[model samples]
Target: MEYRVLLAESDRSMLERLCQVVDDTPNFTLAAKFQNVSDALGQGAVFNPNLILLDIEQPGGMGLVDAFKKVYPAASILCMGDKWQAESASGSIKAGAKGYIIKPFSGVELQESVDAFSRLGSDGSAEILVFFSPKGKSGKTTLIANLAMSLARKSGEPVGIIDADLQFGDMAVFFNLAAQTTIVEAVRDIRFLSPASLSSYYMPVAPNVSVLCGTRTPNMIDKVAIDKLENLIAMSRGLFRYILIDVPAGFNPTSIAAAEASNTTFLVSMINGAYEIDHMKRALHIFRDWEDMENRAKVIFTRVEPCDAQARLELSQKLGYPVTEIIPNDYAIVSDAADKGKMATDIRPDSPLSRQVDRLADNIIGRKHRIRWAGV
Candidate 1:
């Protein structure tokens, strides 16, 4: 199919560059080019454009999305800007734009943005969440499962779970999914895959939720490079609305990389271990230097007896770091859900454990998370 692109930009240099680039791209035709929004709106229809690259930074530029739609209803309008602007990207999407891209972006970037953002219903970015545990048996996997379920149910969008434990991830076992391909295959083939093709590697375990299972054997962990895993997560952002990564327990490269990539990192510990608080304290001190560590990284303690505000405050005071949330634990419900291949939220939605997870899901969506690291 031919992509007859109409370009509108206030900057003359950018307009020329976009016109040249679009004309040079495969299957792309520079239907028309203009230095301002009004000209595009006035004459864009004559081009019969199926794709439009519009600058959203100029005065009255963003407001033309609806007009462009009215003029060329068949065109896929991609908003462009001088730099990253969340409000602009969101507003363009809300105003019927297919996606947003930066100025001087290549044809590959342009196509990728449109294809990826189209996955979301009037949204652009995904919530990359990292669930970290100081050690194994922190109930992090269970937390991911229930929270993912809640998120999927509430949003009715695709949620991705990447079991990055490398050695002993139980995501497939918990979901009762027999993986035909695991992270190993994904990493091996990642260099040759696109968002749509890579999606085939993930197994659909629940409605609107998919799991990229870990290696079939512990030794296969070596095949799953940390860089590749991060790249996999990056590529997945285009595909999933909410991506929950279950990193290996402890502060290894995989865990650190995942945490750094995520907008929110849930640093989880449980009451079963007496040393958990100390471990959490150590992790907090290490993470303090990271940008917005105080905000993006949440301190959570599981299996607490009280699981109250007082407990959170006391623990926060004890650790010299704010305790963000707590989970009330009853092994029975979690185990029962796992045994039945169902979600804890599905089994006991009103249970304390499930309720806390539901609240967490809400927080993930409702909370304002800073998307970029500062001083970049």
Candidate 2:
């Protein structure tokens, strides 16, 4: 499908250069170009381009971000300016740009940004998947790492995995990413969060797969409120095709908030552990009480050994929840991939375990002919 783009820059020469580059790109057409933010805002509603390339610093020193957002809320805006002007970049994001490309960037960079925005239009709502377990060592991080890559690979779309486990999250370790930025920093400036600012906090782990690692300090958890978390997830729905949130164990405020914000909550557990069963029951009880959560909860049994069929049956019967998918106890493959900081989907795409992950992705994206596990 052809994409219509609106390029808005006060600099006439730069606008011409960007137009030329957009013309050369495949499946993209420049619907309009404006030398001032006012002109862009005046025509935005009528033109209604699918994507917008906006300049933060324009004539009259007016906040172009605010004006354009007021006019066109659906168009994905790409903020352009000097990278050092972080405040302006942040402001533009707060005003509702989907992504941002710094000034002096290559033509390739502009083309890629446009392409990402174009893909967003195809996926109606960005699919967000949150992975949470009752406690640590339940393979939540491992599952998320593999699942993020698998979803991206299978669907050929952008996928984001967030380590919402505020304290003691190991998502970065599992992916070999340095924990430089955390959701803590992003939430601190929650007022400025939009697609562009959200994109700035992400660390790309693989092609079309990015991660938002959790904060290291427990105190940082208090910095992120439920509303901020919900807003972040809501804004993310515009940029990503799939989002996997790696939630912390136990029913704390953050975990509860994450569960509420997610479209589907995969209550993960393991077989042969009475504590796991008890935790699952407690989670169910909590979900049952919350009037808003009854429809969005599903039980996913992880690390199930073939010999533990009886235990699995008892657990499923007791909880009255269908065991959506039983991930086999394959520590060798899971642990090796985790230790090496490589995704299992990348290492063993043809393996039984990999096939299971693929199936899980299909279920999450609503591609398979199975019953809807959650209302969403």
Candidate 3:
């Protein structure tokens, strides 16, 4: 598990500091260190490094990115700069750098960067599904979490959940994971991140369900730019089989952007006394105007009563759209599971609610239905 590191920094002070840090870091061995760009490019291959921490801001440093990328195509190239230089970082990324990290970072940060890069693969294709609700209290988070676990289990692949509910996301509480790294940081540094590096930001709650949390404060939402959020979603697609985004409720920029990026957007509404159907109708109209959404988008009704064929038909007729799913109200089981930071299915595998979720998972994976609901 040891990572062979090759570092190149022209600055004497910084080079010395980084060399000392790398030498002392565990599971990492400094294969080589150079103060000159030529020396690094000339002898980099001999080291056979797993990671190359290059100073892209140094003289001829930017050009070395392409040279190393060509020579050592398998190595993880990470550009290090004196500060957060967006333009230089963007250039490094364009030239094939996996990511960029600010200089003077601690040993832990360096290890994290290396570890993140190690987790990536060549293929980045994944199914991106965004779970969006017209308003709050729609059970969107609950549904997404359970569905994520189900999909992971069914597919036998890792599933990633981006808690895009920036203002007040409950994913951390739902999964009972500590907010280690939030989406705010991921979006801020996404331009310089890769699939391997992106994995570092997520907290793995289930065996195959990884979660990237939301902002700790509500005001931090404005800091997550639209382009950054888009990039995060795109990068995640490469690393996982299914990317589930729990977007903020309502038709804000965050929700809209996530919905657009997803291959399948589930517009969920709970059968509460509120005018959720009306809200969903309006939301559908908005999405229908966008490209590819008319067919990719579907409405899901949660907390439905009876959850039978007749109820489904009546609700679909009332909403004027085909209801893709009707999740029955299982308040006691759901509440107990949520309190324990577990999915309801885990608590009672044969419960009605779990059966409905299982069917939903089966449908998503193109499986034939096994549910025997007769003569409604």
Candidate 4:
């Protein structure tokens, strides 16, 4: 098929060069070139360009991605930059571009990048699970990281971890990953990202599992816009079979957005105090309006002391929701695993903690009967 190409660059000479490249390339046609983003936005829909080479750093450049996505959801948007700006590139992706490439490139480079979209296949949706706690210190991150490994192993499918707990996300540390491209940059550049390109930002921690580290700078969490996050999660769904997001505790913008977008919102609580059930109650109230909230919502009580029927019954009665899963207190194992930066699956496959987490993963997969709790 002849792909319609839109080339928008501020540098006149560079723009002319790219235009020539597009014109000379077979099966590609230069549809239009605008002086600025505004003119492009004004004329983009009329041409219905199938591919766009955008100058993401220019004024209105960022907005142009959003406009094109709104108008031409099927079009592939590639951000054009003089040099790779890892940070700003994420913003471009968030705006809805397929990918970002450094300029002064050959037609071959552009063709390879644009053609990657076809190899990604149709954008597929993923089962999204968001882990949230009303209060911190619930071991949410640990559970998610371990669960990711379990889910991937059991399903034999790709799993993605989006550490949305931007301020204090520890997935990178827990999984023994370095600070590379994180979700913050991923979100910022989501607009210009395709499923193939989006895969570039994740740090692979295990087979079929990748982690998008949260913002490295704690304060940069403020820069993670909630709307963009919805977009990021949506786009990521197309890449992985399951997307597990560890959100910040409490009802904040980031947490709420992640929760709302999730197919299953696991309300987590570590029974640290007698009022822990009360905390879960408050959190449940917030998700009352969610679709089939009861079915989609799950209450996970971690570090359960005397994890028995009586304790589960009492908690269920008080919280008015069945205790979906109970993880016994295994401080030593958990701490050891965390210190070693190992997933529970790897640390102790047969341990009680890993067993329970694996069961939870199975339940989420919905391919098994209800788990009959063994003695804690």
The number of the candidate with the highest TM-score is 1
lDDT of 1: 0.82
Pick the winner on TM-score between candidates 1 and 4: 1
List the global CA lDDT of all models.
0.82, 0.72, 0.80, 0.79
Tens digit per residue, CA lDDT, model 1, 1-376: 6788889888998888888888777888888898867778887788888888888887776788888888888788888877644456557777888766777877776655656665675555578999999888898998898989999998777899999999999899999999999999998987666555677899998888999998888999889887888778876766789999999989999999999889889899888847988898887776888878877888888898787778878888888887777899778998898899998899999999988888777776666343332211
**CA shift of 272, model 4, Å:** 1.2
Task: Name the top lDDT candidate.
Answer: 1
Please give the range of 10 consecutive residues that has the lowest summed lDDT in model 3: 367-376
What ranking of all candidate models by lDDT puts the best one first? 1, 3, 4, 2
Q: Give the true-structure RMSD of model 1.
A: 7.9
lDDT per residue (tens digit) for residues 1-376 in model 3: 7879898898888999998898898888999998887888788788899888998776676888888888778787888887644456556666777666777777787876554444433322467889988888888898989888898888667789999998998888898888868999998887566455678899998888899998888999898999888878876754577888998888999898888787789999999878987999988888877676645787788999888878888888988878878899999999999888799988887888888887777777552123432211
Q: Can you write out model 2's per-residue Cα lDDT over 172-237, one digit (the tens) per residue?
A: 888888867888877776565445556778899899898888887777788788777776776566
* lDDT, model 1, position 326: 83
Model 2: how far residue 1 lies from native, Å: 9.3
